[model samples]
Target: MHGSSSRIVGGDLASVMTREGDKVSLICQTDGKPDPTLTWTKENRNLSNPKQGRKHTHLLTLVREEDAGEYRCRAENPHGSANKTFRLVVQSTPNHMGTMVPLLVGLFLLKVFFCFLLILATFWFSNRQKKAPVMREDTTRG
Candidate 1:
């Protein structure tokens, strides 16, 4: 029986966009009479050891700006071979201070309000104590 040529299960050549520190997966499914060997490359450089077969999916965790580039997946068997290309684009993370500024301001204002209440409570207690002694003296004289 003649073995069928290897082919990608899905159509190839895709562009992937993600922010820095995001996780992404590049898939390369293969179909053939015999299971095909798979390999992956980034910018023409091998991702793993040449002898190792990386089949199906290549996962990237905590993606960085440097990880953005052209990637390729190749499936090969005795009968034939197939290739798929992917272009990864990484975007910068949004400014955190845009949200943090408001949060910080809110916390500062809350602290100031609590301090003002504490000061008023201290003044009231001191005045009450001073009047307590005066009232006791008047009652004693009467």
Candidate 2:
């Protein structure tokens, strides 16, 4: 979805997800003068930037089922603010394997949860490393 400073003007943000919980993507396009900061929010909470850039396009990857919700994109500049909304629906395959299938699904879900947590942790640690030196240099200068 797109938004503008004076008037929220743009197209719908496009997204795709697999029913088997394999992959996900979110794309937003916006057009405005002086450009606008594009951001995504779910349930009123601002999401972390998936990438660093000053462009009007934002992309998010590998979305999970829990990420499904009313997604709003807000574009804001010194002039004004604008926004757009989208509903994300994550589908899952039906379980036809009976009782044992439920247990297997539970375990699989747990595995995916831990894997996501691990990825998040790794990203956090990597970001810390990249910023620590800059922070130290600034402190030393002061």
Question: Which 10 successive residues of model 1 have the least lDDT summed?
Answer: 48-57
Residue-wise C-alpha lDDT for candidate 2, range 1-142, written one tens digit per residue: 5544534444555444455555555555555655766777877888756322234333445556676777777766666766677777777666577778889999999999999999999999999998885534456565
Against the unseen true structure, what C-alpha lDDT does each candidate score?
0.85, 0.64
Report the C-alpha lDDT of model 1 over 13-97, residue by residue, as the tens digit. Answer: 9899999999999988788767788888998898864322335788999999999999998888888988899999999898899
| Cα RMSD, each candidate | 6.3, 30.0
Q: Give the TM-score (vs. native) of candidate 2.
A: 0.50
The list of candidate 2 runs beyond 4 A from truth reads: 1-20, 49-63, 99-142
The residue-level lDDT of candidate 2 at 6 comes to 34
TM-score of 1: 0.63
